[model samples]
Target: MTWTIAGSLAVVPAPTRTDLLAEPVAKALAALADPDAVGVAEIDPSLADTAAFCEAYGSPLEASANCVVVAGKRAGEVRFAAALVLATTRADVNGVIKRRLDVRKASFAPMDEAVSLTGMEYGGITPVGLPAEWPILLDRRVAEAPELVIGSGIRGSKLLISGAALAALPGAEVIEDLAR
Candidate 1:
C-alpha cells in the first residue's frame, strides 16, 4: 500500500548508523523493517516539526506519528520513555504513562534533558533508537496504521515505515488507550 505523499516526495534508503542520533534508529530499521520498506526523505530543517512537515509535504495528519519523551520520578529515581501517538491525538501522559511507569506523575521531559539524554534534537526524538532501557510505548492506533511518518532522530529527515515494522522494534510495547 502506498503511503501518504509517497509519490510526491524524494524518498531514499534510510541511513544506517550514520550519526549518533540516527544510530539506534538505523539499527532498529535494519532489524525490524523489510528491505526497502523504510524510506527516508529530507526536508527543510525549519519545517521538520510534525505540523509543518505534514502541511509542507502533503502528508495526512492521521498518517503522521509523533514520538514524545516523557519522564517521571518515584523513590528518587527518574525514568524516561518514548511515547508514540498519532499526530491527531495526544499521548495520555497523566494517566496511562504515569501508571505504566509506576510513578506518581508523568510529564513531557524537559527539552534540554530529552535532547541531551536521547542525543537527538528537541523536535526529532523517535522511538527507533532510544536507549535500550527505555520502553517504547506505542499507541494501539498508531500500531494499527498501515503506514506512517515519524522522526529520524534529526531535524532534516523523516522515516516512513509500516505500523507492523514499528511495533516489531525491539523495545516497542503496544499500549491500549495510550493516546487521547
Candidate 2:
C-alpha cells in the first residue's frame, strides 16, 4: 500500500524492514492480520522526538502521534497502560485515565519503568507491541485521523499506520476525551 504521509523519509513495508523495529514491534507487526498496511521509515535517532522529527522530515505535527505510559495505583497494586494521543494534545491522566484504571492516582510512568516494561526505548514507545495485559487507550482524535506517524519501538525509525488499524490493536480501546 502506498502511504501519502511520507515526508522526507523513505517509507517501506514494515514486514520487510524488521531491522528498523524493536524486537517486540517486529513480532507484533508480523502477527498483524494485515501487516502490509503498516509502513516503516528510518530516521535520525536524535530527531525521534515529535517536534524535531516533524520539523526535520517536513511532516505536519498534527499527523504525528505520541504513546505515553502511565502508572496508576489501586490499593497496593499498580496498573500500567499506554495512551495514544495526537502530538498537539496531552493525555488526561489525572482525570479520565485515573478513573478508567480505577486507581487513586495516575501519572506518567517513570522513563526507566516504561522502557523496561515495554521493551522499547524512551521517546520511541508505541502501543503496537505493548504487554498483552496492558490497556492501550487511544484518543478519539487519534482514532479518527487518516494516517499518523508513530514510534517504531526504536529511536532510529518511525511507523506509519492508519487510525483504524491502531484502534484495532489487541487491547486497544477508543476513548473519547482521552486527550486534552
Candidate 3:
C-alpha cells in the first residue's frame, strides 16, 4: 500500500502544532523544526501506539520507524544516546548498544530518567530531542522508506520526512542489522 499523510485525501488537517509542545517527544522534535526538515501531521492524541498511530494516519508499521533513547554505562561513565531502528525490529540493546557504550549491559533508558533527562513524555520520545553530543544509530531500512511518519517529537503528532532526511540529522550514521 502506498503511504500517504493524513491529509492526502483531505481527511485530516496538517499538524499546526509542533510535536515538542507535547513533552519528551517535544524535546526530540525540537531539532527537526530547523531546516524545516519535513512536513508534520497531527492525528488523534489517543492513538499513539505504533500500530494505531500508523493506521489512523493510513501508513503501515514498516513505514514507521521508532526511535529509542538509551542510557548506558561505559568505564564508570554513564552515557546516553538514541537509536533509530525499524519499528518492526527492536534495537539491539544487548549487542550493538553494549559494544557501542563499551558497557557490560545496556537497555532502554529508565522511564523516569528518560523523562527527566530528555524532558519528553514517555511514548513521545524521539531521537530529535537528544543532546547534540549523543550519537544516533540509524537502521539502514529506515533510510529507505520514501516517507516516514515518526513521532512529532510528541505522541499527539507525527512528522513526515523521507528516510534520507531523517538519517541526515546531525550525529546520525547508517548501520546494518542494528535491530534485534
Candidate 4:
C-alpha cells in the first residue's frame, strides 16, 4: 500500500510502501496491526519452491529475506536463542548472536523443534509463526528494499510485506550485521 502526505507545502509519497497480496502476506499484515500483517503466497508446487515462487511472481531470489530460528544457551546460566537473518548476510553465530544470547555456541533449531514450535515448514519458519516469546532479530539491510518477499508462516507459498512493517512487529529488534 502507498501512503501519501498532502499538505500546504507539497504532496509526497512516503518513503515506505506495503502491499497486501491475497496470500500469506495479507494475514501477516492483519496480525501486525490487530490480528496480523504477514501473508503467504502460494507458489508452484515444485521442488525448487522459492525459485519457482519468484519466477511466477517476477521476484528475484536476491530480493528475498531469509529468517531462521536458533535455540541455544544464553548468559552463564540463562538459556535463550532465536534469530532472523537476511538471505544476504549470515547469522552472527559467533558475534552479536553469541553475545546477545550470551552463549558461546549457537546452532539452528532442530527441524522438528522448528516446525513443532512455529507450525511452519522447515523452509518457512517466519517470525510471525514463531513462539510468542521468540526474539526476532531483523537485519537492517532487509529494510532497504522498497518491499521484501518473506515467509507467511508456511512453506507452500511465499508472502510479501514492507520491510518497515515487518520491523514494526511487536518485539522485533533492528540490528546491523546481526549476521556474519
Candidate 5:
C-alpha cells in the first residue's frame, strides 16, 4: 500500500523499503506487530535534520518528533536512554529525565557515543531501533499525536508512525511533562 503524508512525502510500507533504513531499523520494522502500518519515505540525506527536513519537504514541525539520546550517571555507573519529544519542544533532561533515571544529572550523550551505541547515523537516531536495555521515554503529547514523522535510523529516510504504535514499542513509557 502507498499513501502520502507530511504534505509531499510519498510513504510506503516500511517493511517493503528496508533498503531505505538502517539495518537495525529494518529488523525492528519486521518485528512490529503490524509492520505495514508504519510508513517510510526517502529524502535527501543532506536535509535529514528536523528543521531542514521539515522546511524542504513541507512537513510541519508539529508533526515531527525528535529522538534524543541522553546519558545519566550515578556512582560511576552510567545509564543511557532515548527521549522522544516533538521538534517544537525540548526534553526536560535536567528535570523529569534526571529524576526518572534516578541520577544526579542528565545530559545529551556525545554524538559519537550515541551513533556508535545505537548503530545508527548521527542525525537520524530513532526510537525504534535503540538498545533494548535503554528506556524510551515518550512525552505524553507525543504519545497522543495521531501521526508523527520520525527518523529511520539513517539520514536518508524518515518513518511515519502512529502515537499508539510508538507507545506500544518495547521499553516505551509515556511520561507527563517530559518536554517543554
Candidate 6:
C-alpha cells in the first residue's frame, strides 16, 4: 500500500529494527507496531521542527503530534516522563502533569538532558523508544487520531502510524486534559 502524508509526503516501508541509524525508532516499532502498517519518509533537516514540517510538507497541524520530555523533582530525586500532545495544543506541565507526578513542580526537560537521555536528537525526541521507567502520557485526542505523524528519533525522517499503535507502546497512559 502506498502511504502518503497529507497527499504530499511519500511514505515508504519504515526502516527495519536492525537499521542502525534509526535503532530507537526501529526498536519501538518492533515492540509496539505491526511492521506492515508502519511507514516512514525522509524530510529536509531544516523542517525537522513541527511547524516547519507541517507547513512545508502540507500536513495539517492537527495531524501531527509532538513528544515532549518533562522532568519533576520530589524528595530530592528527579523523575522524568514523556508527554504526547497534538501540535495544536500544549502539554499541561505546570498543572495536570505536576499533580499527576505528585511533584512540587514539573517543567520541560533541558534540551541537552532530553537528547542525552533518549539517545535521540534535540528536534527528534520521540516517545516511542523512551526509557522504560518513564511514563508515556498521551493526550486523549492524540490517542484517538486515526493516523498521525511523529519524529523518527532523527531529524531526517518521520514515522507515520495509527494512533492505536502509539497508544500500544509500552508504558503509554491515556489521560484527558493532558494538553491544553
Best by lDDT: 2
**Please, what are the lDDT tens digits per residue for candidate 5 over residues 76-125?**
99999999999999999999999999999999999999999999999999
Error of 6 at 60 (Å): 1.2
lDDT of 2 by residue, 36-140 (tens): 889999999999999999999998899999999999998899999999999999999999999999999999999999999999999999999999999999999
In the range 1-180, model 4's lDDT, one tens digit per residue, is 321110111211211122313233344455555332333344543522555555665666666777877767644553444566556567887677766676768777778977776656667656664555667788777755556666655555555556777677766888888866
1 or 2, greater by lDDT? 2
Sorting all predicted structures by TM-score, with the top scorer first, yields: 2, 5, 6, 1, 3, 4
**What residue pairs clash in candidate 2, if any at all?**
none
lDDT of 3: 0.69
The alpha-carbon lDDT assigned to residue 174 of candidate 1 equals 97
| Local lDDT at 57 for model 1 | 83
Q: For model 1, how does the per-residue alpha-carbon lDDT over 1-180 read when each residue is reduced to its tens digit?
A: 345655356777675424423656666666663746777887788988888888888888789999999999999999999999999999999999999999999999999999888877878889887888999999999899998889988888888888888888877899999999
Off by over 4 Å in 4: 1-29, 34-39, 47-52, 55-57, 75-81
Candidate 1 lDDT score at position 148: 87
Candidate numbers, best lDDT first, in rank order:
2, 5, 6, 1, 3, 4
Which regions in candidate 5 have their CA more than 4 angstroms from the true location? 1-4
Better of 4 and 5 by TM-score: 5
For residue 33, model 1's alpha carbon misses the true position, in angstroms, by 5.6
Instruction: Please report how far candidate 5 places residue 82 from its true position, in Å.
Output: 0.2
The digit string of per-residue lDDT tens for model 3 on 9-101 reads 122222344432455444444445443445556566788778877666567777778888877787788888788887888988889877887
Q: What is the lDDT of residue 1 in candidate 3?
A: 27
| TM-scores of the models, in the order given | 0.91, 0.98, 0.82, 0.72, 0.97, 0.93
State which candidate, 5 or 6, has the greater lDDT.
5
In candidate 2, position 54 carries an lDDT of 94
lDDT of 5 at 59: 87
State the TM-score for model 6: 0.93
TM-score for candidate 3: 0.82
Among all windows of 10 consecutive residues in model 6, the one with the lowest summed lDDT is 13-22
User: After best superposition, candidate 4 residue 6: deviation in angstroms?
Assistant: 28
